[model samples]
Target: MSDYLPSIYTKFLAQFPEVAEAQGAVAQAVRERTPFDERTDRLLKLAMAIGAQAQGAVKSNVRKALQAGAGLDEVRAVALGAITTCGFPTAIAALGWIEEVAEAP
Candidate 1:
């Protein structure tokens, strides 16, 4: 629903409205079921995205985390902490994506 969402994602959402609605419902359910607060949830999502090597997710979560009041250092820390679990290259790539989003106007 964001204007900034990637074109491919927007196209998918447009092409499969039902699927998009279901996905949104699932995401909402997860948010309601989770014990973590918004910022923590965003950070956790960022970590998961990093582990999955999903650049789009990493960038998206960085923006979401910041919007949820997470600090820049906190965002950077999440990417840095992934190095051990996700390997140096993946972590570095995630960090680059994080910076790309974080530095964007």
Candidate 2:
């Protein structure tokens, strides 16, 4: 696991060791199979999260995207681009989710 994982994720993994191991295995497989760089992967995941209207996932991926060297505009673009497919309201909600983390102190 990467040192960059959020504390909440660590706590959840600690609380559910079986799920943690499975998650680790799946993550490793995805990494091994994908050719995209970390930044692209993060952004792509963020877009998916946006489409799903998953608030926590949107925020989490935004943080990872920034850690992977994505700029604010790049992150914002992902949310904006989702507007077409996810609809205006869902995309707007995702933007709020993104901001919750991006603007954190």
Candidate 3:
């Protein structure tokens, strides 16, 4: 229900309210079960999104990371560090995606 949620995702949630509720519950459960703090969790998700080469996920995680108090440098470091594990192209693309959210006013 966040205004910042992508329109497509909002529509999907609206169309499948029950599924959305279940998905939200699962996400909450995972967060509660995780040992990592919110900032670390978001940063790890950002790294995974970079590895998966998912632009939207990368951007979303970047925003979440920032909200969780991650510094800009920390976000950039995660993307840059992916170059060795995820390759240069994936890292570069993720950096761009990070910028899209990080630089937004």
RMSD of each: 2.1, 3.1, 2.2
Superposed by TM-score, candidate 2 places the C-alpha of residue 64 at a distance from the truth, in angstroms, of 0.3
**Can you give the lDDT of residue 14 in candidate 1?**
91
* Top-down lDDT ranking: 3, 1, 2
Model 1 agreement with the true structure over 1-105: per-residue lDDT tens digits: 132878889999999999999999999999999999999999999999999999888888988998899999999999899888989999899888977886676
TM-score of 1: 0.93
User: How many backbone clashes does every candidate have?
Assistant: 0, 0, 0
TM-score of each: 0.93, 0.87, 0.94
Candidate with best TM-score: 3
lDDT of 2: 0.86
TM-score sort, best first = 3, 1, 2
Per-residue lDDT of model 2, residues 35-85, tens digit only = 999999999999999988888788888988998999988999998998888
Off by over 4 Å in 2: 1-11
Q: Which ten residues in a row have the lowest lDDT in candidate 3?
A: 1-10
Q: Regarding TM-score, does 1 or 2 come out ahead?
A: 1
